[model samples]
Target: MNRRCITGTLGPGLLVLSLASGAVVRAEPVFSPAATDSCVSAAYASSPGLSGHGVLDCIGRAAAACMMTPDGDTTVGMMVCLDGELGYWNARLTAAFAERLADAEAQDAELRTLGSAAASIEESLRAMQQAWLSFRDASCLYEQAQWMGGTGGGPATLACHLHETARQALKLEGWWAQ
Candidate 1:
């Protein structure tokens, strides 16, 4: 049995959660985990056929590719790969928000409350997205600081950004689903 805790490319993610290791170690420091963002929105933006889970699976192939590639072996390279994937998801989110706004303008003209135009919902979404952007940035900054100046800080910080952005993308996808 290969006693080496960190072996060859098991999959996309840094830490392999599988038959090899019964427990996914919390501090194992994944080198090349699965890509966080689902590349689905690029194709099915603002559509209801796909769910958040679908998005997660949609990127599975790319994640596996990343695992095989040289970049998957290093923390820095993995960060770059994740950042690239995040871009795709972010684009989908933007498209989703725009699609929602367009729908609102065309049919749902009812006021949100009493005299407040339903357009306020658009404003609310815009505000919420901006706030989330700020929060993700700030929180990652804190995470980097906490993980020390460098050793693990860069990877952790990038991972935080990737995870949070992907999460937000999923939320936007959920909105798109609606």
Candidate 2:
């Protein structure tokens, strides 16, 4: 077991790693999902019919708030905050994907019933989603690579993940609407 202490703005984030299984555990501060969700909700409320990248304005509010905290001021803390936001976006992405897939399947069924030989929308959606995932991973990896193994790489990668996830989530969420 190896333990490393990364200092934050107000305190320290303890990072623990186990050599045998290649597992890592970290005690770091995470942003509040309620706060982030509230911010996003407010953005939508303020801008009636808000969709697409317009929702991005609310993306970093909670992370910025978390970053202001004593436990979130350090690199590890920032990563945790970014991870929290990424998780939020991931949830949204999952829901949006499910909704879109279901809609596509329904549409395909309708087209089949009508004897219209249209292409499979569900298959196209699945392919696009897979490609997006690959693109997001590769793009984030490139962003991290730009840091050259520096400590900044971790946060950069996380930020990239957050950005990509949020973008995809919003895009998928508004797909049928647009």
Strongest candidate by lDDT: 2
TM-scores for all candidates: the values are: 0.57, 0.80
State, as a TM-score between 0 and 1, how close model 2 is to the true structure: 0.80
Candidate 2 overall lDDT versus native: 0.81
Report the error of model 2 at residue 127, Å: 0.7
lDDT of 1 at 168: 76
Q: Candidate 1 overall Cα lDDT vs. reference? A: 0.59
Candidate 1: RMSD to truth: 11.6
For model 1, what is the alpha-carbon lDDT of residue 145?
97
lDDT of 1 by residue, 54-124 (tens): 55545434444564576464665555555555565567677777876676554445564356644466666
RMSD of each: 11.6, 6.7
TM-score, model 1 to reference: 0.57
lDDT of 1 at 31: 31
